[model samples]
Target: MPGKKRILVLGSGMVAPPCIEYLTRNPQNEVTVDVASAADLDTHVAAHDLVISLVPYTHHVAVIKKPDGMRWLGLFSTEPASIKNGNIFDTLCHQLAKLLSFKPGERDLVMLQHKFIVEWRDGKKDTITSTLESLGDPEKYSAMALSVGVTCGVATQLLLDGHPALRTPGILAPYKKEICDPIREAVACEGVKLVEKVMK
Candidate 1:
């Protein structure tokens, strides 16, 4: 597809499909999935306009460390020997894939909540909380996979669409209202439930 935005997806785990499906829906996105290892990172990352790391979070830093020019979105985690050696990384990838496989009739759950305390100058304070609970259907995506995948997908779409906060060069997190509001709305549109409340 000429003029399409190329998106490189680094893993083929359960989460990859939802994210890939979401990106491809735009017609302007051309997404490629690779069960990529360290040796393949440079070539694959350099070839795409955006990269989503659905691989084990440990490898995210290595992807980010790749030469500039590509944007990325996904969960991130710690360093490991796999970060340096392609062969070790390949072995670990196989092991991780085995662990992530779901059996028939199996289901998963994900719950995320945050509480914030706000203080006023007059010494009054309020408590605010936001909560999200998602349960996976055995016949479909797991809660972990769907939530992570859809969130990554939404952020990727926003970047491709030239979202102001996302277009800046550097690592970005959804800690700010500007970044979180759009994502929250889009994720809700996908049927994920989010609830917010205030207590004084």
Candidate 2:
């Protein structure tokens, strides 16, 4: 395989550890992980080829003060409110697939990825959809920020394995609450269903 790209993941707490674990698992990429403080973000942002910002959406501006060469995969789901519910289950399943690959013992989480659906109630009609792999590709040189509870490694993979066009630049996956909550809930439930139906 070609040498892995030099990647830098910036964040702390819950998301950071797993991000490090996932990215390091693949030898195709060289990952340098760090927890950035407010003061160091600017210099650190400039040093890397790709930056996966696991920071909250509210803090995106602070993290991505300027655009750089790195590819970012925001953990936010960009699906329309109308179809979010049906897709949420599938999204959890995909995420479960990734978690299973990374941490098989954590099957309980798959169930959490299921159960809940995204509810969009406007004046006219209401709709629900799933947020499993609903996340689209990260925009180029932009700060991709994900919200709390975003754990769909599948979407993360999609961002990591961005299309050929992304090669010229980098990609980012910024996850948001609307995207993460359902996946976290559904994955737990789906894991239970999968073990009973297929794995058994």
**Top candidate by lDDT:** 1
Residue-pair clashes per prediction, in order, are 0, 61
Using all chains and alpha carbons, the TM-scores for the candidates as numbered come to: 0.70, 0.36
Off by over 4 Å in 1: 36-38, 56-101, 117-127, 198-200
lDDT of each: 0.78, 0.42
| Candidate 2 root-mean-square deviation in Å | 18.8
Per-residue lDDT tens digits for candidate 2, residues 1-200, read 23565667665534455445555666676776677566988887777666776652223222333344111222243643333337754444344333333242221122123333334466443333332322212331111112222343334433457633223333333365544444445444422122111111
The residue-by-residue lDDT of candidate 1 on 1-200, one tens digit each, is 24789999987767887888888899899899988568988999999988887864333333335433122221233433333345755655444444445777988888889999989899989999999989998987888778888889999999999889887789998899999999989999987867999975
Best by TM-score: 1
